[model samples]
Structure formats: C-alpha cells, structure tokens
Target: MGSQSIESGPIPACELMPASILISWHPPTTADVTVETVPPEVVEGENVLLLINSLPKNIVALAWYKGVHNMSHVLALYSLKYDISVTGLAHSGRETMYRNGSLLIQNFTRKDNGFYTLRTINSRGEYVSKTTTHVQVYTTLWMCEHPSISGKLTVESVPPSVAEGASVMLLVHHLPPNLLGFSWYRGVFLSEVREVSRYTMPLNLSMRAPAHSGRETLYSNGSLLLQNVTWKDIGFYTLQTLTTDLKNEVLHVQLEVETSFSTCCNSLTSAPVMIERVPRNVAVGGSILLLVHNAPDLQTFSWYKSMEKIDKFKIAEYSRAMNSMTWGPEQTRRQKVYTNGSMLLQDVTEKDAGFYTLQTLSRDLKIEVTRVQLHVYKPVRNPFIQATSNIVAVQSSVVITCFSQDTGISVHWFFNNQTLQLTKSMKLSPTKCRLTIDPVRREDAGDYQCEASNPISSKKSMPLSLIVLAF
Candidate 1:
C-alpha cells in the first residue's frame, strides 16, 4: 500500500503550547467597586450624589439601575470615552452622571428610597464590576407646639407612638425668653449619663458627643429632632435648660419606640382585640401585614376584603384545630393567612385601597371583630411647571401652572428648596396647581419648583429660574 498523505489546514494554536503552560495562565483580577452616599442620610427635596469608589481603570462605561440589577430598570448610562450620558427606560430626568462614574439625584423624594446598583463596563462592553447601595430618603415632620404656662419649660413628644425608623420631635414648650443654654441626655439626668447634645447661648453653637449617632438635632428653640429612631433609643430623655442668670430647669420625657411586632398585652383584660397595619402608610406594589393584636385564643378566624363582614367578600379563613386555611373565591395568590389570625397581602394594587375586616371566634365562644382602612396610594409622578414667561418686569403678573398626571395628589410649590410662602399678591387656583403672582418682585427671581405628592410618595419638578427685571 502506498503512503497516504493526510492534510490539515493548520495545526491548532493550543497544540503548539504545552498543556502545563496553559494551566498556569489566569485572567486579570478586577478591582472591587463600592458606592457611597455623599451626605449619608438624605431628606426629601434635597440632592444626593452616589459616589463611586475604587473603580477599575479598564471601566469605560457606567450604568445606574433603580431597584435590582436589571437592565429594564436602568436609569442612565454614561460613556467615559464620549463623555456623554443616555437616559434609559427608568430615567426620570432627575439623574445626572459624572465622569467619575458618580450619579447625582436632584430633588430626592421617598420614591427614590431603595437599592441602587452601579454597573461598570470595560471597553469591550463586558461588565468589569457591579456594586449596589441603599439610599434612604427621610421626610421631616414638623412638630405642633401647644402653649404651656409661661416661664415653665416642658417637653412634649410628638405623635405619641414613636415607631422605629420614624422621626420624632421632643418639642420644648413654654420656652423662657431668658434661656441661656440647654443639654439633652439620653437617660435621666445623671453625672455618668450620655449627653446627646448641648448648646451654648454665648457661642450660639451646638456640640455633640464624640460617639453621637448623628441622628439627634438640637434646634435653636430647645427642641430635639430625632431621625430614624430605633428600639435602642427607647428610654427616658432629660432636657436641662439654663437661664442667663445660671438658674437651671430640668424636665424628663420617656420615649417608647414601637416595633413591627408589638407586645400583645400586659394583662388578659388589657388585651387589644384590634387589627393594625404593620406599616401605617403603604403604597401600591407594597406588602402589608394585617397584624391582629392581642386576639383571644382563636378557634377560627376569617378575613374579609371589604368593610362589611359579608361572606361573599371573605378572602381567607383559618382554623386553629385543623391548622388549615380555606381561601374564598375572591382570594388571590397575593393573600396569605397566618396561624395567628393575621393576614399578609403582597404586591398590593389600587384595587386593594379599601377597608379590611377581621373576624375571630375564640374558644370561649366569644366573637371579636375589627376593621382597618388600607389606603394604598399610587406614587405621584414628577411634575413640571409652565410659566407665562421666564422673565417678568416688576409690577407685572406671572402665572405658573404645575401639571401632574396622578389623581388624588396635592400640589405644593418650593422656592429655593424651601416651602413657598404665599403673600397677599400671590393667589392660588382652587386645585393649588396654579400660582399667580399679581406683581413680581426681585425676591421672586430665584428658582421655583412644584412638588406633586400623595401620602405614599412625592416628586418635585426641575427648578425653573425666574428672572425679575427691575424697573
């Protein structure tokens, strides 16, 4: 037989290299990227920047996502080479990207509260790094002061129930005119107690403890604003005020921070047979635990979607003996019945914005029923303002209209990042969406923005700078 010539186009590159050499080769390690909030905690109607740190040099592109690390929630994409940014489906026009891969959110609102993911891409369009950070947007609650006897200092805790993660104000009522300074203590006034903060009248300056949590604010009016309170904050707080003459007045107020799971009752007679929503304020697409507080040992319990206790509206029923659940025809997968007679509703929609009834039958043959109103609100969208003109002469009238697509929303105006105060010459339309300034003044030459808000969320428009030409 003649030798056969077997031909191949070319020998594979891997065949030219030893298998041992290939095993020694490894890909370059990517740097770890992290995101930080510039000011840490941000309040509503403010601006915050998501600062990116330790970004890899190979990263040529950056993208920001809203909730999860999903492309559909992309807010904006920035290209380092082009130095340009493109908005995505989730863009609200309030997000701006910088060359350093940082993102700036203007007019931040509660709707902006959640996790934000940053993805970095290399020149080859491969993901080099991804990091996520949570942003919490807080809402400031103004305290209402009631008059106390003059010259007598008093401390009043606002809202009664100081829920965790909620803000509380310890308002000082009947503040004496001759007040010199004040100090707030975490516990009752003691030499070894932790001093939250202190203010001095002479210096007009406030000093906080080195270990202060940065959540306490001592106001000029001698009030203390506590933000994002936790269970550990529950205790007696003492406020000591000193007069210019060196006389001191001490007062104490106890703070009871409520948690998601509250005590049923101290005594059987004091047991509360009521239903409460874990989160008092719930928005659409949110979950709520319709917790039954201090209900007697229940033999059976039923939950109705409507205020009426009719059987037709029943959504779920549970039996203690059988440890089983019976779902009604109206029940959906979103409804869950707990053994403790409580119900959890998830992914709530506008249709669930009504009253809910809970009926329980105890083993003692006593029946207890309670109803709670669930206001599931749709978050208000970002509003825009349209003015008659950007420039107005003194003594000329200018009408500004705010447009919002959400119903059941209230419109508010902000000037220079503060609530707009209406003057005698300023008139608002019936819906408060239209503001007419009969005569413009130089003071109105600053930025103006309109905020549309519901109980659930709020959003402000881009600032519209008004130029008032002096006549």
Candidate 2:
C-alpha cells in the first residue's frame, strides 16, 4: 500500500483507461532493467506504493506513468536536480512520491486500478531503468452491498411546553443500531419549511453557528437538551437520521414557549372561577364543546386566541339581546357559537391544538374569564404482550416482551391488575421494550399485562396468565 493522494482535477489515468486494455504490456528492451511483481489486491480508498526495485544511487529524474505507451499518461514526475515534485493533474490531491525510486498513491480508487510503470535515469545518463507493475483495487464490501433499512425512528420531547428561559429536553427513540448519524433543524415558517438553524449529531466541536451551539447538549442515547430556552426557540423541530443500511427517517415535534411573566387577568381574578372544562383530547372528525361556566349575568361574551403576548384575537362572540351566536370570518367555517357563551368545534384536527381565552365585561371592565388548552390526536391502537414462557418452573428465568406498532411510546408492565414495581428480580431495557425476570417463583405467577402509551393515548394489552410449578 502507498500514501493517499490529496490532489483533485483532470481525472486519474486508471479512470480514463478502459477495463479491456488494463492487461499486461511488454516494457522497452533494456537488459539491465528489473520490475517487481504486482501485489495481489488493493482495497479501494487505500494507499499504494509502487517500488522501482533496483536503480543507480545518483538518479537524474523519475517518472510514474499509468500507461506504458505514452508520456501523456504520466501520473507524477520528479526532478532530482531541482528537488521538485509535480503530480499529474488527475492525481493532484492524492498522489505523492518518495526520495527513493518509489511512487506513493493515496486513497487508491477503482479508477486507480491498472498497470503502473516507473522510470528512473542516472545523472550520468549512461543507464536508464524502467519497471512495470500491475495493481488491482477492489471496492469495499460495504459499499458494494448497500443494505436496506429495516427499523423505526422517532423523537420525543420531554415537557413539551415550557416558559421562556426554561430548559427543555428532546429524546429520540427507536433508532436503529446501524445508524450513521442524525441532524436536527429548527423550522422557520416562511412560505415553506425553511430552517432557521440546524445541529448535527456526534457533535462537531469545530462547527460555528450551529442551532444548538453552546446552549445544547447531545446525549449518547441521541437526546438533545436545550438550556435556557427562549421564545426564539419556539416552532417545529425536525430530526433527520441516516443509517449505514442507506435508510433514512425524519420526525417532527412542535414546541410551545410561553412568557415568563403574565400580562393576562391572572391578578384580576380574586377567586378561582370554574367556567366550563375544556376537553383537551379529541379524535379526528370528533366534536368538542368548550363549556362556559359561572357567567349567568353576563350580557355578552367573546372568545379569543391568546397570542404570545397579552393581546388576543377574537374568534367568536355571543349577543344576549339577539340570543344568537356569531363567528369570526375565519371561524365560521369550523366553529359554532352557542347562546350560553360556549363554543362547539367540529371535525377537530391537530391544527386546533393551542391555548384559547374567553373574555367578557364585568362592570365596564374587560375581564378575562377562562383559558382552555386543546389537543387533537389520532385514536390509539390496541397492543398485545408476548412471553417467552407462560408456565415455568420455580427458579427458572423468563423474559416478557411488549410489542407495539407505534413508534414513540412508553411501556408499563402490570402484575395482577397492579402496576409492577422494579425489584431485584425485575429489569427493563432502556426503551422498555423488554422485561426480564431472572428467577421465577410462585410470587411471579399472575395475570401479566403490558400497556403502551404516548402523549396522545394509551393502549393496554390483553392479560397473559402465568403459572409456576413448585420446586
């Protein structure tokens, strides 16, 4: 093997030569010239060293060529008198030479595979020596056989909502073992999905101006923790992961950042007023009523979406004189107002998730009555549990694994209708995918259940009864 070349331009000779003509070619008739045998194989992207076995001590010049027939096929040339080395344009970045009658080629690509010839001339010009060697370079096995991706990828944000200047953590789950690296992007909502900032995993310490630069830490488990998060950090974040199997997956998470100081009617409300309870969880195409409470004397009521600041935008309103409901231009299509100061939202969607405020007048003063938080999620699926051995002898080991089609979820195990507690005999994997019981006993016998849950919903698996035999 030889040193890798660092030059890049005009392609190398091996790349230009057709595979059909890379065969052995006779060298010029010179009885004194000796050529060394070619190596068996050279992996692509490795260095190659071509040696001109024996030559006179005082060498006037040395030339390394890709083809034996022409000077135009020269790969590198050296001038001993001037002590200068000029590499071929095609091999500029990756080729170098030794003081001795040898040539060093770095990162030998398949395009570098073929016959290489070296020529040396003594200062006296009395004798000239030339050697020809055949070089074979093969592509790396992994590159030749690109694997397909066969796993899932997900990202979870711990404490999805936070006040400005608070810390937040984003956790990644279900990353494949063959993963190469992952990248994170803070989405900028322009006309499209523009990225305001980005962060790459495996932490490039030298990178400047990265989104998470200086303020974020990446854990070995692929989690990112942001310290002192600000309103600038609010928006959708995307995580893109690539694996060695040539597979890739992208996940998105929305982050809501609130102000540290409140400007709304928090101080004005002397007592905790219960209006109507807002249903936070709703399925697609479902109906939800933002119930109004304790406002029997109000002449009129108005609903608004609380903006980031203290200001609000009216979405719907009710008039007591007309005994009718009126919606804003944008809300009339999806939202219906009731005479009781309540709002009915139909065909709920993920877009409906946010904070809403209801406002009304009390003694000529605008008073903010209640705030509602809404979330729309897809219906949860039913998951099931599987055990390696349902019936086992005392003192035997058993493994229980939970299975779910969902990507991001939390697994909870239960024994005899009670939440199972971790003990000396119980161990769970980091992702909670599997539970292991090292030694089973009579106490281990029960109705085992596994529940998989996420922020959206929870699904319980059918109980699998376990039996234990006496020792």
Candidate 3:
C-alpha cells in the first residue's frame, strides 16, 4: 500500500474546557407576622378587624383560612402583583381588605366561630409566614327565633320555694359568650322591671340597684347570691346581658319566699313557735313524745297527721278558750294532748308511719304561730340471706339473695367482715337485694353476711360460711 497521505480530516481541534459557571441563591427569611383583634373577641353583628403586623416587604400573596390548617379550607385569598385579585367564599359585601393585608369582618354570626389562620407568600414566591387568631360569636337569648337550635337562657333557684331569712343562689344557664355587660332585675311580673344589679366585665365595674343594700352579690360567671332573703324578695327575677353585638339577652326566674316561723320568725317573741324534732323511730308497740319548744302560755294547739296535703288525718283539737280537748271520730284513746304543745301516743304502729303536723294559732286564732312537720318511722326487721350454694367449685357461678319482711328496705353485703363493692365479675340487682358472683375461686371462700336497712333502722343477718373447691 502506497504511503497514505496523512490527511487527518482536519487537525483534531483541541477541545477547550467549558468555563465553569457558579450561581448563588439566598434562603428566604421567615415573616414573623403578628395578629391582633380590636376587642379580642368577635360578637355577632359587630365590626371586627384582624390586624396583620410585622409583615415581610414585597409580599406576593396573602390568604386566610377559617381553621388552623391553611393548606385546606381557604377562606380568603389576595394577590398583590400580577392578577391583583380577591377570592373567597366569605367575601360578602361587608368584608373589606386594607392595604396592609388586614382583614375586616362585619355583621358576624354564630357561624363565624372558630380559629382563623393567615398565610403569606414572599416576593420570591415562597410560602413563608403564618399566624392564627380565635374568633367567637355570641347571640342574644331574647332572640328566640330558633329555640330548638339555640337553647333558651334561664335563671333558676336550687329550691324554687325558699324559707325566709335563708340564702338563695340564682344560677344562670345557657348564657352566650362575648358579653359586654350583665344586669339583674326583680319585679312582680314580666311587664314591671326593676334593676337589681349590673356588672360590666370589660370595665371591671359592678353597680347595685338602689334597693339592693349589698344583699345581692354577683359571681364572675353571672350567678347572683341573695343573702338573708325575706318575703319582700319574693318575685320574678330577670337577668339581662348587654352584649357588644348590640343585643339584649334576658332570662327570668320566679321565686317563692315562705315565712317559716321556726326559721324566720326571729321578731315574734310572744308567738307559740314550733321546733324541729329529731326523726323519731318507735317499735310496733312503743310510745313516742312529740313536743314543741318555746310555746307561749295557754295557747291552744292542734295535731294533724299529714300523710297527704289533702284528706289529712286529724288526731286531736284543743282550745284553751273552751278548756277542753276534742278527738276526731276515728281518733282512739291511745293519744293524749298536754297543756303545752305536745302529743303523747301510747302505741305506734305501721299505720302511724307518717308526718305529723303541729298547728298553733294566736289566742284569737287569727294568726298561725308556727307550723312544723314531724316524721315518724317504723324499724326494719326480719332480714335473712339465702345462698344458692354454701359450697362451690372453681369456675362456677354463685348467687346470693337477701330478703326482709319490711318493705322499702335496702340490702348491703359484707364479705369477711368487709363491705362488698360491686365489680365486673359481681352484679347487684336494681334494689341491691341480690348479688351474683361469676367464676368462683378458692380466694373467694369466706364468711358473708347481709344487712337490711331503712331510714328508720337496720338489721343484719347471721354470717353464712362459703367453701370454694380448687380444681
């Protein structure tokens, strides 16, 4: 082969190294945005501003959400740059956005209650800052347009019928939050209204009515305590709340104050006052003394057996003016009336297990000196226990029953001289008259007894020995 002409296609061009290019990027700075509210609380039908402070410069976008999570549930969105737009379902005619990215809400309602979150984007289009605020809306109780949905606000006394000279508490329930102020009123009826007390929470001020005389004290939760109540306090009480939302919520309560001579008659020195008796318990054939203290001289006394308000059993009636004691047609000689206000019974039977009312009037019988309720009771007797089996094998179930001849007796169980408590493995009847144990074990072997008790007396049954066989 001829010497080939060395024609390398073109001198192999030297491949020059491409110049290395370096680029620098800066991490975005977090926008420490602070959120604040004008009143700190949002009320219905009120204007509120959610202020945004310390926002980063050159903000590209800002958005708000109803809840804490901003990724979902977007409430409002704004774009400052290209599209320059506002979009959100809550964007009613009343909502307005300020130049500084603050949100203004107007005519809010209960539906606006929740945590509101804010999200901001930096100029570089990076998700940068976030803040949250809680908003609450309250509605007035007088706006009963939706009674079933919004529970009615009410003020009620623990005991609707309270004795005079006693302390009574007025409890307010179902009250709305975000209250501007609250007031109390007392009147004979709904039409007549008189202020009793007023409290302004925001200002930390409290005012009492002219007639209050410091007897009415208000609690932080809007409850009122009336001290040393008298018959004059008996009336309908109303609770009024002046909410920031510009609505008034009112709750009403009716109080009945009774003049109890025993408890309220401190000024009656000459009246034959009645006293409370320690509950009396007498055997079937035993006698009991029902006596009154501080009875005036020579005041006639009357005794009545009150099983029910209607059809009372009149035991006896005595008149000092007549100087004679008369007995009811059904009253027997077993009862005797004394000069003082006291009744003596020779024998008490189950039929006598009821409240006895003592009625004493002034000498002219124009005014009742005192009225009291005397309770008499018969003791429970003949309590016995019956076991399904005195001896039982392991993993077997055992049942024990308690019985008493007296009705309305509660039965209590004891094991190894210790009171027995109901557990998952043990069950008791509704009346606690029966006890059942499942999966008997050797550890369960012990002496068991039962006791029957009533308000009057208690009786225990003999101890029954239980034997458990191990498998």
Put down candidate 3 lDDT per residue, 1-471, tens digits, no spaces.
011111221211111101110011223355356566654434478888888756777666676767864344545555554323344554445556654668888887777766777766655445566666666554442111123432556676766568878989998766668788888787422232367788888988887775565788987678899988886575557788877888987666656576544444445564345443333445667777776655665457667775222234777778887888877644767887787777777676767655566667655554443333333456867565656556566887777766555654567899989998666778886557767889776778898888878666898888878878675
Q: Where is model 3 more than 4 Å wrong at Cα?
A: 1-272, 275-279, 306-313, 364-366, 369-379, 421-424
In Å, residue 115's CA in model 1 sits off its true spot by 39
TM-score, cand. 3 vs. native: 0.41
Best by TM-score: 1
TM-score of 2: 0.42
Model 1 per-residue lDDT tens digits across residues 1-471? 111111221322232212232123223344365566766546689999988766788666667889853556767766666555666667787888777879999999989888887777665445666666667665442101111222356676786568778999998867777878888887554443488888888788998964358998888889999999876576567888899888888877766567533453455654546666778768889999987867758899988987568889999889989988898867999988888888888999989877677888887878876666676887777876756556567887777767665665678899999999998889997558878898888788888899888767999989988878774
Candidate achieving the largest lDDT = 1
Candidate 2 has an lDDT of 0.61
The estimated TM-scores of all candidates read 0.45, 0.42, 0.41
Deviation in angstroms for 439 in model 1? 1.8
**Clash pairs for candidate 1:** none
RMSD (Å) of each candidate, 1 decimal: 24.9, 21.7, 26.2
